[model samples]
Target: VWSREEEVRHGTYRPQSSAQLKATLGKDGKISAWRTDYVQSGDAEGETSFIYAIPATSRRHFSYQSNQRDGPWRSVNSTQIGFYNESFIDELAQAAGEDPYQFRRKHLAADSRHLKVLDTVAKRAGWGTPLPEGVGRGIAIVESFGTIVAEVIEATVREDGSPQVLKAWAVVDCGTTVNPLNAEAQIAGGMVMGLSSAIGEAITIDKGAVVQSNFNDYNILKLAGAPAVIDVHFIESGAKMGGIGEPGVPPASPALANALFAATGKRIRTLPLMTQAKA
Candidate 1:
């Protein structure tokens, strides 16, 4: 944590700032220590748009094993933060010269319960199997509000540079679920919402006005563009009850991004994976 005096001395505390973070992982593939610092380049002005912390996404649970913020509970918050954190997890896996799935497994020693969902989802998705060129598979596990969800996404980057989600599998552990059908529906809806945000949804500002006002202009996922199959599997972990609605939203983006990376060897660092061209 940088104090205001140290921030001013280092010219880092200001309205507009950019930050860089570093992570040190132990031999066991868990983070040992993490540090980030902000570098501000603008005047100390009216409203600040710069802040940073350990991401409060579901991935936070993983880092607790390594010894690692709370904020408003929102689906989009988890979606966006999970997107970022899980993408980095894949990168770290790659950097360690390990398969992403295996890398995640190595770091799951702290919680076999989490691994339960991961193993189920991976088996359903056929992890470690090879796919045809232009097709890729990615995996993500998220625990939110005591409900854990592990999802696998299979995506194909078409010749025309479009990305298509072929299938999705979600293994959920929302303990003592009362209504299985409604939980399935909520998880499915959350997955669709997360995928839409990851694939095509965006908001723009033009001339001090909002650009996208409705569904037509907003460009959400259409029925024809939806995944061919989305399988939701529930695991009654016999723990206390948990909600199902929001946990499903967070992993969709990262799983899709990881799938794209696997398929094309092109890592995605931003949202809306289709908008960017392969390098």
Candidate 2:
């Protein structure tokens, strides 16, 4: 679904990606192995970010795009890779005809920190609980900068097919939480940024120069479009401290995408969903 022409790109420093992922499942419908090939280029090189597995058997290969104009880079390039792979995991679950949340539980190790955090978000969000018609819930987990974070996003599609997020539940296990309040803020801010990037932000070029000079075209998330509630929880797993700031951003996009898919039968394989999702 992600072709080069469909790749999001423009005059901004933001990167672009082309990804192809394939997996094999056992007779039990559990993912047995996978091979992921993705190419991404930004102002700097971005390798594959992260993947989740129990008995790991997967390979990911990264390549640089020769055409990008180099500038600066982001510390959380993992967000892009995490978004790609995590969404594919949900796709795998759907192919197996299993519930996405429970499917993740089956594939993730039972006693590991990843599962613990995943379970926490599901429980906190009341996974499998009834929702008002037209509302759908999506769950995603990602580990970036060593921190494991899971998120559940509840949203519904507008008449125009744009997703309107209603609520968010996030759980993180990054070892020690020296300051609970600040850590919570970090996660919340990152999640908001991630959602903004996914749902509304886009860049275009005209005559070798960037277009969309004002908010009219270059839109960002507004308060009305934000989730009504964001609940953040922390888990100290007594392991080496990972990171709090960047980990929160990785899982937000995938969770929202999955939520929108649940709300509408259409899957999101494109960004700036405000424009692309109408189809």
Candidate 3:
């Protein structure tokens, strides 16, 4: 005998744009030009306008399974996310009269997931606490692999634009943790992987051949670049372990990005921060 089951949940929220500037208001008290269409107007005069539009939409799906007739079940999941195009960001920037990063930060602050991660990191890293001048700190987190993980990284940068990984702390809640040691290792390994990506490592192609062939050119984390401290804490629950394989990968990238921003006053958007370290 064989049996199978599947369940899925999805949702989307569209935020409406605010009204245009009062100075640019039409006779009917409504902004006629869509925020996305304002650039063509070339209203470079003293007039400024505001309009709201959707940038990008996201969809998520989750799944679980039970194969045995009387044993425990397991879960397998994935997510597909799409970011807004440059035009969407430009329109949003024009409407808010602020840079895209600032606007996105404001919008992300209102998201429940982002807020949860931010709050957790703030508490974990002692957000308002004092620190030395050369020591820089950053925090970020994400939801994936059926769990939520938050990470905070501390580092220092030299005049030549190289970043040193000093320490990292992570918190995860994926229901009940099946193995404490494994969980700790996963988080620690994740931090090192994140560190390597931030400081060194890249893939290149030349003459239709992969330029970087071995670990000599494509470097992983070395002992010197590894974090001296990695802490992982889990919230206990009677439920089963929701995820154990890849949940640890997402938080470190963003945390490293935030750290780079603090250390160098440079906001990096591309992958492998080392590639743009000089930029």
What's each prediction's TM-score?
0.77, 0.89, 0.60
- C-alpha lDDT score of every prediction, in listed order: 0.70, 0.79, 0.50
Candidate 1 lDDT at 155 equals 89
Q: Superposing every Cα of model 1 onto the true structure, what RMSD results?
A: 11.2
Per-candidate clashes, comma-separated: 0, 0, 1
Indicate which candidate wins on TM-score: 2
Rank list by TM-score: 2, 1, 3
Off by over 4 Å in 3: 1-118, 237-240
lDDT for model 3, please: 0.50
Over 1-279, each residue of candidate 3 has an lDDT whose tens digit, in order, gives 221111101111111111121212234332233222111111121211111222332212222231212221111111101011222332334455654334334444363444455456566776656666766666655555556666778877766767776778887767788788988887677667656754676554366344555566766778977878877777654444567656665567666656665666666655556645443
Q: Which TM-score value belongs to model 3? A: 0.60
The alpha-carbon deviation from the true structure for residue 278 of candidate 2, after best TM-score superposition, in angstroms, is 4.0
Better candidate number, 2 or 3, judged by lDDT: 2
Model 1, 103-160: lDDT tens per residue? 7776675456777888889998889888887789999877766677889999887667
Candidate 2 Cα errors over 4 Å, as ranges:
1-12, 42-51, 54-56, 65-75, 275-279
